[model samples]
Each structure stands twice: as structure tokens, then as C-alpha cells.
Target chain A: MVESLSLPKDLVLGSAILTVTGNSDLYIENYKGILLYEDCCILLQTKTCQVQIEGCNLSIDYYNNEDMRISGCIRQIVWK
Target chain B: MNRIIIWLKGYVKVRLSGFSPERFMNLCGNRSIHVWGVENHGRFYILYMSRKSFLQLRPVIRKTKTKVAIIEKYGLPFFMHRYRKRKLFFAGILVFLMILLVMSLYIWDIRISGNYSKTSDMILKLLSDNNYKYGMRKSKVDCEAIEKLIRAEYNDVTWASARIDGTCLIVELKENEILRQEETVEKPSDLIAEREGEVVAIVTRAGSPKVRKGDMVSANQILVSGAVPVLDDFKTLVGMQYVKADADIYLKTRLPYEYSLPFLHTEKEYTGKKRYDGSISLFSKNLKFHIFDNPFPEFDRVEDTKQIRLSEYFTLPVTVTLRTTSEYRTVKKKYTKEEAAALCKENLKKFLDDLEEKGVQIIENDVKIGIVGENCLAKGMVDVILLMEKRQDTEMVTVTVPEDNRETEE
Candidate 1:
């Protein structure tokens, strides 16, 4: 039904959209809340699963009600 | 861009010490209170939030029971609140900006360049007469009109351009390579002999040659005649055609020269004594002070003054003058025979150099420098070759027509 209407899944089905630029920056939209935030790693929860970003020197540049930006040397992005 | 907005609205760097600062941040975020630059300290967390967000932090603080301490407050709203008592300082700033704004609306400097035959001061005077001068309104200045005015006033100016850059009005012009000789009509005159001399050579440009080469012409004799006789088809003189005579007539002549100098002369011998006086002048008023008195009757005084200025075009009415006085004694001195002869030769050489500068050729020097009774005398007769260009108006000729000739023509 969403594809028939030609709408993005993140906007229609309430799914999270993760945009990573190289190994340094990550942008998350349609996320539920921040499960954990540390200098080394950041864990965010979405509608269906929790997205875990593993990196070194990880820090949140800024966060608001709609999206969040994480920047550092990212090593892994595990979904659970 | 977001940082500027945050700064304008004011922000606080908060240090949360109690447990669950992350939960507090999450609650604040869910409620639409934006926070950024979140850093995790070992036992505490530090973050930045706007003033409005900090107000909503109270409810979040109570729910999470986290103690948030404002480490620093920054930006324009807080700065204004802290300096609310200094009204005069702010008013002075506003007045300064207003003055600067008013100053920028007028032209302050006028510069002219590329003018050679015409001086900058003369051009500036012309511009002032035409209302295009320093301190004129920028909006009233028309660059094209200025160019046209300069070209119109100076017939010799071949090209002109005017432009306004910032507050400076720049006008540049180029003068014609050749003088406006074509615009002026030459007077009808004859080239007469300047002096009684033998003609060495003659070159005619616009007139009939009256004296040939090697001809001995008398003083005031015509070298080139301005009235050229017109000839008909049968080679009969019909009338006289008048024209300005132009020609080069080189003549060989002799000139007399004499110079003398006194044997005894008074010379100055400077003594080893000096005095200096310093003074400062302000706004056309000067108060001079010196501690030393004049010790000698005959002394030379030299003054040097320097004016102070703030910028290239802005001058301050302040100057400093320094005066130096040196004592000198006059003594009678007699020139030796050799020195007197050398001095006469040096002066004679200088005179010849001056003549050479004026395109005159010196063929010989028979001058004699000898010490006479009580003085040195230099006398001679020098031979020279020079050009003559003495002109006088040409007398017109009238032809009387007979009554029978006039009736046949009618």
C-alpha cells in the first residue's frame, strides 16, 4: 500500500532512516528515543528494533525531537 | 546559523551531577526542548540549552531528580541585561555610527592624474569652478559630465575620464602630443636679417629665398621675402601673393665678451659654536622658548619645520620648528694669481655651456684671462654660427586698373 502511493517507508511506515557519511558522521530520523549515550558508543531505539552504533570517541553533535546527529570514528552499526 | 539563533536567544551551559542526566535529556528532547553539544563526564554530563529549554528543565529535573547547575550564561540577552545601567556608553556608540554614516555620503578627496602641460592645481581650480570639487555630494556627481567639461575647457586635452571610487573622485586626462599650432593662423611677415653677417647657408620652407649661400647681406636685409610674385601662363607678373615667411638662415658672426673680478674679497670663516631652539605651534598659534642667548654678532640662522598629519588627506593644525644658529667670522682674503686665472676659466666655461644648451654652436674661443693693475680681466672676441629669425610685416601691393580694361571685363 505504501509503494502504490509512492511514499517513503520511513515517512509512511514510521521506520527509521540512517544516513552515514564515510566513517565519521551519522544522521538518524524517525527514531523513538536514545537508549544509551557514551563517548565510545551510542544506542538508539526505533519502531521495530534498536540501532547500536559502535565507534571510538563517539559524541552526539546535537539532538532534537525529530532527528539526531552522531559523529566520530565509527566501527560498526549493529541492529538488535 | 543555529548557533547565532541560540546566542541571540541566550544559552546556558548546564552541568548535571545527579544520576540519570541522560533520562532527563531524553525527556526534554521528547517534549520538544532542543539541547545540543552533549558531552559525557565520568560522573556528570555537560550540555548546552537555550533559556526557554532551561526553564522547562525544572519539570524534567523533578521527574529524574537530577541536579542541574548552570556553569555559564552567554549571549546578547544576558549581555544587555548586565549592562543596563550604562545608557550613556550605548548612546555614544549610536552617535558615532550616525556620524560615520553621514560622512560616507559625500566625496572627501579629489585626485587628478596624467596631466603634464596643465598642472594639478590649475585643473583642480577648473573643477572647483564647475562645482565638481571635494566635499560635493556623491549622488550629485556625474562622471560623464565631468569628462565632458574637462575636454571642453582644455582644447589641448585629447582624452579625459572621470570616475568615483569610494569617496575619492579621480580624473585622468592626456594632453595632445602636438601643440594646437594648426588652430592659430600665422601672421603675414618677412624674414629679415638679424645682423650684418655673411650668409653661410639658407633653407626655404614657405617663402622665396632673397639671400643665397655665401652672400654678404646687410643688417635688416630681407633673407626670405613674404610677398611671392604671382606669374601668369606667359610668365608675366600679374600680382603679389602674401604669405608668412619661414626659413632657416645660418650666419657666421663675431661677438664680444668681457668679465672682471676684484683681487681682494671678503670671505666667511665659521667658528665652532652653535645654538638650537625648538618650538611647537598649535592651531596657528606659536609659543617659542630658548634658553641660550645670542653670543656672536654675525651668525647664520637655519630653521626646519615639520607638520603632523593623521592621514593622507587629513592634516592636523600642528607643527614643530627647530632653529639652528652658527657663528661665523668675516676676513679679508687675496686670491693668488693661479687661483684667479682658474676661477676666470671656470666662469667662462659655464657661460659657453649655457650658450650650447640653447642650440648655439661656438666655433672659436679667443678669450684672454690676465691679472691687471688691481683686478683680474677676461676679454675676447668669440666667433659663432647662429640662426636668424627676425620677422616684420609685409607691405601689401596694389595694382591700378585702367578704365578701358575694367569696361571690357564687365
Candidate 2:
């Protein structure tokens, strides 16, 4: 039911596959998996939540409640 | 409202909430709101708001819409007040200057023209005596009175007038032209017989004689001579002689007399008196009153005459005197023959005495007397002649006969 959800045109979600399991190993596309694993965080990658950051730099931290930081010259933020 | 009114006065627009204070704050979540306040009274206030806010809160503020006037700085009332304040001082000064100018234009000096013998000082003295003088207003000087005074004092003046020229009083005088004297001498003069009487006396100062005394000479006969011979002494020369002669002759004459007496007597006296006032006009329109009438019943008659003499400036004339002659009737006595005779003799003697006093030498006389009707009238005629000696000294001129020249001519 969540996969069939629709949002308005001002919001958008990215297409990336990810599985959520106990102690799963996931390799992020823009960042090295070791950097995420060293942070003692779970790598739960999903195509729905995966976002391709353009003209921006991305960071993920497991200890800060799945907080992802975006930096660089960002033009806009969209949620769909 | 006061703020809005002030803003309007300064060319500004104001906006404010349009509702009760409490309701407006409650509607706005108890927040403070900025409003344009206008003091309508000591206790009440008016608010002005933008169009949008007014429309949104129309139902609330519509009941509070109190129309007010806003005056601009350059409006009629502002300019009118300023102009009134500025003109007050200038208007007062203008009025004061006008009054001063008029006062300065009054008569300052009296000027006289057309006067040769009568001086300006004389005219001024006359004018001053009659209430006209320097620094007097033009309206104050009585022109007719002055003219009358000038005419009365100056007889040679034919006319006089006065006027105001600028700040000076101009007086005009007209002097009368003097009349020429007439000559009464004639040429080739002769002493004619003034009366048809005998040559009682004759005296010739010049010319030759044509008659002698004691000879029968008629009227107009040349008794004394006017023609004379122009001659030199001790020579046949021409000379002039003035002759005189006198003669005594008799004459017969008649006389008559008549006298009338009033049968009744009548008398009259004046019972009424009249008064007169005089005035003169100068320059055709100026009028002046000079005399006031005083009444008297004792006067027999009243006469007044006015003479108008016209000239360039003044009109002058003599006041012709009008007089009244009173007459009355009374009784007179008649004269008898003896009285009339005596009167006639006395008159004749007086006449002869008068002639003797006038250098007439009466040499002889023949007289007669007569009576007529109830009166004794004297008819006396006399040939009383006299002599006037022509004793003029003659100057003799001698001419020497040259003996050698006569012998040479022979």
C-alpha cells in the first residue's frame, strides 16, 4: 500500500532498492559502505527512499537517528 | 482623526481601524493596532483607514463614518488671512500720504499779475484784511469780497479778479486808459464883439486898428486894429501896431416883470427805509458778497447803482451815486410898485458895480424908470462906455543911410 502512494507535483520520491534485515550489508552508490559501516549504523537501502543528489554532496550517520546531511550547491528540495 | 486632519492639511493620506477600541482589539487577537487619530472633541475621536481595511471592516466602521473637511495650505482662507494682514499697514500709509499731499497743495503765496502801480504787497494787504491770506485754503478766500475791495480802493483799476493756481493765489488787475486832453487854440484869431452893445472899452494887444472911440460904431466893426505896418525908425519901414479905443453912446430899452405865489401848502417826509447788499462775480462764476444793508427811516430816498467793468482778470466799475431831492410848498408875499422899482434899481447898481470891478471904466450913463400894472418895473437903458489904453512899448530899429554909397549910386 505504501508503494502505491501518490504525492503532489511539488513533492517527489527517488527510485532506489534497499532491503531491511538484521545485520544486512548495503553498499551506497555515492558513498563507500565502509564509511557507513564504520559509523556503526545499519545499511537499509530501498529504491523508494534512495535519492540521487545532483549538484550536492551527501552524508549519512547511523548514530544520529538515520540522519542524512546534504551539502554543496542545492537548488531545491522535493517530496513526492 | 486629528492626525488625519493634520495629514490632510499637509497633503498626506492616513489609514486606521474603523471600530470600537475594545472590539477592534479583540477581533485582532488582542494585538496592538496602529491607527490615524483625529481629535473630534475633548472626549471623542475619529479614525481614518485605508480602502482595503475599510472594505474588510465595513460592517464595523460604517456606522462610525464621520465626514470631515481638510483644508490645503494654499486655499482661499489661508491666502485671504495673509493678504489682510499685509495690506493693513500699506493702506494706512497710503491714506496718510494722500491727506498730507492735499494739505500741502493749499495756498502758500499770493501772486498778482497785470498790476503796474498797485503792488503785490498792496493786493496782499487788501486780501488779508478781508480774510484771505497765505496758507489759507482755496475755499476759504472769498473771491467776490476781495474783488469788491480792490475796486473800491483803486479807481483807475477797471477790473480785478483772483484765482488759485497750484499753491499760489493769482490776482489780476486791469488799469484804465488815461484820456487825452483837448486843445482849444484857433488860427488867425480875432476879438469879435461878444454882445450887440456899443464899444464901451477896447484894447488891442496886437495888430492895426480900424475904428476910434466917440464915433458911431456898429456891432462887429473892428474898433481896435490887428494889422500894422512893418517899419523901422527914421525910415520908410513896415511895422505892426496893437490899437485900443473906448467910446460912450446912449441907448433906449424896455423891461417886464412877473411873479406867482402858491395858493396852498403841502409837506412830505420819508416813512420807509430800504437796505442794499452788494456782490461781485469774478472769472464769470466766482461769487463774493461784500455789503450788508443797514436800515434808516430818516433818509428821504434810496438809490443804488452798479457798474461792471470787464477785463482779462477782474471786472471793475464805479458806483454811480443816486440821490433824492426833496421839495415842499409854502406861502410867499407879493411886491408893490415902489418895492419893485427899488429892487430893480438895486439890481442895476449891482450890475454896474460888478462891471467896474472887472476893469470897465464907466465914463457916462443915461437911465430911466417906469411902472407897469400893480408892479413897478424899471425900464432903464444907459450908454456907459469906458477906455482901455493901448500903451504897448514899440522897439525902434534904425537903419543908417550910407552917404558914400548914395553918392556913388547917383
Candidate 3:
């Protein structure tokens, strides 16, 4: 399931992300559009794009092409 | 261009830069748009184009704007930087006004004071001649040079200085002081009898008594004299007199004049023509003009002149005046012996008449005439001396002790 969640108030979307307790190493994506990355930030087009993540204590990895990866303790998943 | 216009139709505003009024007008070239106005500020150029053309030519104009730095740098931002753009113009106007104010404060007129004999007109002329004149700029006038020139011309000036105060050039002068010689007072001196006769006047100021009036006294004899007395309380053994004495005495003398003449003509002569010139000096240079010249050469000439220096030290020439005189010559005729004698007697009578007017008494007279060298000459001499009486009052101070004081002291 794609877990949808509202961004935390203290979290900056481009610089960091939040993790919930649910899944880990879950493969996911039914993307509506390409999420381009620039300057360590993600640009999501059309608001309907979704992604699934497995982990709680999520570790984020930044890519040279300005993309971000998520891993670690999973708590729950959400989609919107 | 049509495509560019279609592309620009979507935007509400278009900006153009780097185009001056002339250049912009040239570019407009038959484009229908009202020209509002043109504004110039030194090297900066700003042209306003209507929205229609601005949009239509945006692509082409933008290419032009990039080529010109004034456009690319200042064009778009000038509207937002209005204050900075007007600063230079305002500063230039302020500087120009300041210069005008300074120039107006410079001296325009030079006024002199403390001048009596030196006329204002002459002083002004002198100043003008020395390049320190009216309407001359203050910076152009050298005060030292003016002072030197004036001092050189006017000798009576003790000192002179010039200064510029606002629009006035003030020239202050000090005149030289004239010194008068002191006269010496005569001490006690001999007052001798004036003439050989009786003492007529005796006025003793500070001397002992000598002789009284009506006393026969010879010339050089003391009348009211100069001698002081030393006395004892018993009123004895001291004698002296201090007196100023005068006397008038009568004397008789014999003198003769002879005249002889033959009928002969004599020439009468008169003076010659005269001319006078007036001169004034300024800055050591003299300006002179002759006021009068004798018209007749045969006439005798006489000239009179007066000169005064306006300043004592500077010795500036204030004014010089001269008078000229001319006299003509006339012929004279000779007279026979009889006529000569009669003329001599007439002349003698006229002389005696003059002497009578002067209070002289003629006691006796003798006359004679002789012919010599075909001319008649009359000779006569008269002896007469004045007899006059003068009385001079003498002041005598007598100090006497009162009888009551003497008795009381005794």
C-alpha cells in the first residue's frame, strides 16, 4: 500500500524527509510523472505522484543527479 | 516582425532602451505614435515608446539594448533610480550660482576720504591713470601699486593705504603735519633814546628808572632804564632803574638836485609777452598744459606761479596755477631847460606833498637849475626832520609797612 502523509512542520521537503513505522525494503512506485531533482531538491509535478517506502528511522541518501533515496526502520505507509 | 508582434501581443508592458530622442524618432519613421517629450541628462538617453510599437519591436529593440551599455545597465533601472539621475544637474546649477555670488562681491568703486586740498576729481583721475579706476575688478587692482603711485604723486601725504571691503575700495590717507618755528623772547636789554632830542617817552617794564620825559637826551641814552636797587631797612644806599626808553628828535639837512635838458626825443619801453603752464604728477609722470601765452613778442613778460603738493610724503601734485603778464613800450619826448626846471620843481612839490601826507615837516629847501649837454638839469636839496613827542608811562611798585604794624612789632 502507498502510504500518504502530510509533511511535518519542522521538516524541509527538499533537505529532509520523515519516516513512519511500517515497512522496510518494500519496492514501490506507480508514478504519475517524473520527479525531477535539482540542487538537492525534488520537484513533484501534478500533486498525484506517490511512492512507497519500507522503514522507520529512515536514512536518506542524496544523489549527484539531485535525487534522494530513503531506507531504514519502517513504521507505516500512506498515499494521497 | 508580424510574428514578433503576435508573440509580443500577450504581454501588457514592453520596455525599450538605449534610444535617444533623435534616434528614436528616426527609428519610428512613419510609425503612428504620439511623442510625449524628450528629456536629456548629460550622456544618458531615455526614449519612451507606445505599448503597441514597444511590443511589436521588442525583439529587435532588445537586441539593440544589449549592444549599448547605457541601455543594458541604466535603461531599465533609471526609472527606479530617478534621484541618482538628477544629482549632477542640480550640483552644476549650485556651483554656477556660487561663482556668480563671489564675483558680485568684488570691489566696484574706490572712495577716498580725509582730503582737503586734493580735489576728488583730481584723485579720481590719478587713480584711473594708475589702472585703479572705476569699474575695474577688485582682483585686478593691486593695492600696493596704487598706494605707491599715489604716494609718488602726492608729496604732502604722510601715509596712504588701500583696502577692499565688499564692493568698496577704501583709500585712507594721512596728511603731513606743518611745523611752525618758535620765536625767542628777548631778556632785559638796553632801551636807548631813539633820536637826538629831549626824552619824550619812558615806559619801564623790568628795569630801574633812568631819565624822565622832556629831559634833553642824545641818541642811545637810556630814558626809562634797566637797573635794580639793593636797599637797607633804613631806606639808604641802594639805587638802580629798569626802563624801556624812547624819544623823537628833529634834525635839519641840506640836499640839492639840478636839471638841464635840450629838446630831444626818448624812447619808452614796455615789457614782453609771457606764458605760464600748469602741471600735475601721477605715478612719477607729469601732465602739463600752458594756460596763457603772450600774443605780442615786443611786450615784456612776467610770470607768477603757485604749486601745492597734495600729500606730504607722497608729494602728489594736486594743482599748479600760473599767471602771466605782458607790457608794451612807449616813446618819450625831451624838454628845454626852462621846461626841465619847471618839471623838476613840479616833481619836488609832488614829493613834498607825499611827505606831508606821511606827517613829515619840511623846515627849509633850496633849488637850482643849469644847462649841460644841450639839456636842462634842476638840482635841489632840502633839510627836514620830523619833531614828535611820545610819553610812556612807567609803573612803580612801592612796598611800605603800615605804621600800626611797625609800632606793634616794635
Cα lDDT tens digits, model 3, B209-326, are 4666567666655554433555557755334443433334343333344444456867546554445454553333556665555456455544454334222321222335454555
Stretches off by above 4 angstroms in model 1 are A1-80, B1-109, B114-119, B131-142, B152-158, B164-168, B175-179, B268-332, B399-410
Per-residue CA lDDT of model 2 for B79-132, tens digit only, reads 455678678676888898885566555565566888877787887787877778
Give the docking tier of candidate 2.
incorrect
- Report the poorest 10 consecutive residues by lDDT, candidate 1 chain B: B308-317
Question: For candidate 1, lDDT tens digit of each residue in B154-179?
Answer: 99999999987766788999988667
- After superposition, the stretches of candidate 2 with alpha carbons farther than 4 Å from their true spots are A1-80, B1-186, B190-204, B212-216, B229-327, B330-333, B363-366, B386-410
> Whose TM-score is greatest here?
1
| TM-scores, chain A, per candidate | 0.92, 0.25, 0.30
Candidate 3 scores an iRMS of: 25.8
DockQ of each: 0.50, 0.00, 0.00
Off by over 4 Å in 3: A1-80, B1-185, B198-217, B228-267, B270-298, B304-410
> What's the TM-score of every candidate structure?
0.52, 0.26, 0.29
What is candidate 3's CAPRI-style docking category based on DockQ? Answer: incorrect
Model 2: DockQ score: 0.00
